[model samples]
Target: MEPVLPLVLPLRLRIRLAQGLWLVSWLLALASGLTLLCSGHLLVQLWHLGTFLAPSCPFSALPKVALAAGTLALGTGLVGAGASRASLDAARYPPWRAVLGPLLVAGTAGGGGLLVLALGLALGLPGSLAAGLEEGLGAALAHYKDTEVPGHCHAKRLMDELQLRHHCCGRHGYKDWFGVQWVSSRYLDPSDQDVVDQIQSNVEGLYLTDGVPFSCCNPHSPRPCLQSRLSDPHAHPLFDPRQPNLNLWAQGCHGVLLGHLQGLASMLGSMLAVTFPLQALVLVGLRYLQTALEAVGGVIDEEGETQGYLFPGGLKDMLRTAWLQGGAAHRPAPEEVPQEEAPPKEGLPEA
Candidate 1:
């Protein structure tokens, strides 16, 4: 058995193994490229899906179509490039020629495996996948607001509205002091009040109406109570101040966008996990094999030179050709080799 193990493989067996390895390598390269392409396409689709679903946003189908087309083109390019590179490399290096068949086969199989993994993860882990994205966006928004000055008028108005809409004022003629007719007329006669009285009344009214109690000022309150008759729900919906409709809408939108983002992230993460590390390992192995083959070729070339049968058509010739072309300007013109005078044949021992 030991002696038999050292026997050379039949030509048929050797050819089959070579074919298998080539197929595996080509498949791996193609699969890696296709996975990358699909990931990109999915990302674009996610964006277009988000925009399309947005309530107030205008939807254009062009982006979605473009994404699909781009992905298709990318996949085609990847497969083509992988096949071409494998073929070219195999032609250039004899050892790689053996492994190419197996590599192509294995690559195809691995890529198919990764595609299955990506699909499974996309189906299984969407929301959990997207949570970090939401948190990150929230943090970014907080940071941006902290660094930037309030720029828009609407922003200021929103801030003011948020602060002022829900508080209670004192019962006294708070309006008259501030020269507001509504509060002054409700409690005090403007005609009867002295200048000082009017001023006090208006200031009191403004303070009572504007000052929000800690309990009533809770921004999260769906409903807030104020210490005034005007705070009743029927009279002033603004008494609560918080916009439930807007909050609900915002929350719903956030949830939906988050789900989409999570779906995408999970799909991408799964693809990377399955495809990248495996592909990298395959590539490393291929490189090592390539180096080993080159070493063997070097030994072969040396042996061939000793035997006066060195093959001219090889990497050495190709490299020499390339070097000559690149250094054409620097290279000296070939000098003619002049034949030296032949020595006279000696007929006898030198005298």
Candidate 2:
């Protein structure tokens, strides 16, 4: 197969390419950073929503969207910058002489910056801010509790009704009301069978005593009914029989887990966004510096073509010039010419 000739680009095209790359790099870096920042905010909002909304609703979905968008933007920017550096190197130098410093600086600075920012926003700032806001709101609401007499009255009445329904008279333990058991005994502690048996017996006995009708008993008795025997309401459970406290517990757990996951995703997204752009900027700066150094040092070839300044010849020249002009006494010897005595000896061979 015939080898394809390397296409020579016009000077305008080359300049445009450089400028375009620079512009894209800057824009992408900026965009990635901003997207990450926004993603962080969204993450915070999602967590805040989780406090009020059900886990399956906006609380669960928004973070996934933010994470997906932010990650895509960040990753694209980083990949573009890397690819641009590689292309630039390929165009400017021989394959073996291409420099990697610019690429390294660009990738590292941008990637690293984003990483740190994401972590800070996700783990530190958002969580702290949310907590602070929640605490402040709680305090404000607490202050208004006394002034809101009607609402307070309603709340108190509701509490009283709940207490009556649950058989929570403060004197009767939670175990008696909820059919739960507290086993402090050491032998029962280790044995699951014993624990279960104790809990069952306690719960059944408490439920039976509480559920059954009883007349007035002496308050001083150890088994005195703590609650005043008020008029009984509807005789069954307040909550639905099928769905119990288990549903509430499960919902709470789901919300907590979803919030944490969203926070993590947001943090990762932010990190990607901030880190790569900063790195690209650094690389561009380094490349600019290298170019400037080459120009100042007059490291161009005879054809007035400037190669990289830190090339082998340039470094050697710099060292040699520096040493010679650096006040060293040692001097280089001059070249010698052969005398005419050798030609005369050749002619004398005939003699």
Candidate 3:
């Protein structure tokens, strides 16, 4: 192996940078992991809002961004610390000379990924998600009963679940259902004439009606709650929520769920943003550490390369590197002169 080159940075400064990288990397990973873990389930549930939408969810890639950020941050920090050690004692970390090169390249790629992630958060993720949910929600209502009779609508099943789980009615209100006996929802798509005909055929003569489905009814509402009339809400004058059909939820599911998803998107964006600067700093430090190690004769593998040490540099390559990197890189550190005087040459004797 070639002799180690003198370090570019002072020993104490390099140590400080390594310590900082390690500390920040751990903290960033912990924070991102916890935040995502707590909210991931809910985010996944809301992603269903984009299920029926054409082209699917625009924010599908959003959730994984946090995970990637955390992973990269942790890896970069670990590599930085290792590079620092290699700079001090290259022989101990024999493989690092090869490892550090690839890691630095990966860090560069990771930085680009972070930039794209930031753009996704800022430019269009929340809005696209909301739009998809809105369209999907409406489609669910229109196609509620995907059958001849009112019993077997896959879309309706999801809608009912949404209503019950969120304490909501139709996309807007209980009135959105229009009538209990009829499945001809106002949300019916005019383009699908067959679906419209099927829904109308389900409604028959002499059918009694309730204002909303069971899912929209409050748990405290009387058993088999039917919101045709009977209950006098004005009797109390000031009831909670104060809507005409007091027994049934009057609000829409769209606004409530959309708001929640928006909140989640904001949080994801914010936390990701917080990590951005720290990750950037770590990459910078990591690059510096890589430089120091390289200066100390570390053999780094370039991007897509594995056998840097196996192949020696050609005469042309060394000259190219020397010229591009200021001959032997920058000025040496002011620590101490590493060179020793060569032994004096013996005089040519009796020529």
Candidate ranking under lDDT, highest first, comes to: 3, 2, 1
Q: Name the top TM-score candidate.
A: 3
Error of 3 at 268 (Å): 1.0
Against the true structure, candidate 1 reaches a TM-score of 0.32
Task: Give per-residue CA lDDT, model 2, range 273-297, as digits (tens).
Answer: 4544544554544344334223424
Off by over 4 Å in 2: 1-14, 39-240, 244-250, 260-264, 267-278, 281-305, 308-351
What would the per-residue lDDT of candidate 3 be over residues 295-319, giving only the tens digit for each residue? 4455322222211121234556766
Please tell me which model should have the higher TM-score, number 2 or number 3: 3
Which 10-residue span in candidate 2 carries the lowest summed lDDT? 245-254
- Which structure is stronger by TM-score: 1 or 3? 3
TM-score of predicted model 3? 0.63
Q: Candidate 3: lDDT over CA atoms?
A: 0.59
Can you give the TM-score per candidate against the true fold? Answer: 0.32, 0.31, 0.63
Model 3 residue-pair collision total: 1
Ranking by TM-score: 3, 1, 2
